[model samples]
Target: MGLVGAATGPSDGRRARVRIADVALHAITRRAARRIDHIIGDSTQARRATELLKELADLLL
Candidate 1:
């Protein structure tokens, strides 16, 4: 059978947005250790996510 397209909903939009934000956050967090201000130009959500990720990393490390 061929692939079928699924209907999109609000949750789908939210998930897509979250995924994009996560990618940005990860990139910033990975690079920030070497360049602290590199992620300053990103969106607020990305920055907030990065902060949370950093906290989690610190806890785990």
Candidate 2:
């Protein structure tokens, strides 16, 4: 859970706090990507989904 934040910074109480909104966005992006990947024989929907995922991923980066 808190592993990443704990591991990234100094042990001298300098570790950054994790933002809840960022975590939620990441989880949502992963789910959206999976949904896009699972689309079967639907080019239009798949393309739109891919575009949306790309936009969401940009926020992450």
Candidate 3:
């Protein structure tokens, strides 16, 4: 399996704690860096993306 697949799962299947944390950060950073144009395709999508991005920023910065 991939790094993330190895990192997450039941206790018996989980990877090292450091590996899990690294994979989690790698995932969140990639997701948080996605451009709006790459994501929003319509007004409905735009509104939802806007709200969620705002919430993410509020929680992070």
Q: Cα lDDT of all candidates, in order?
A: 0.63, 0.67, 0.72
lDDT of 3 by residue, 1-61 (tens): 3454334356855544434457777888998898868557788999987899899999999
Q: What lDDT score goes with residue 13 in model 1?
A: 52
- Compare candidates 1 and 2 on TM-score and give the better one: 2
Q: Rate residue 42 of model 2 by lDDT.
A: 83
How many backbone clashes does every candidate have? 0, 0, 0
Q: What TM-score does each of the candidates earn? A: 0.32, 0.37, 0.36
- Tens-place lDDT digits, model 2, residues 1-61: 5424333346656666554466767887798777434554588887787899999999999
Order the numbered candidates by lDDT, best leading. Answer: 3, 2, 1
- Ranking of candidates on TM-score, top first: 2, 3, 1
Worst 10 residues of 2 by lDDT: 1-10
lDDT of 2 at 28: 75
- Whichever of 2 and 3 has more lDDT, that candidate is 3
- Tens-place lDDT per residue, model 1, 1-61, is 1122333357665443223355566777787768545546668867798899999999999
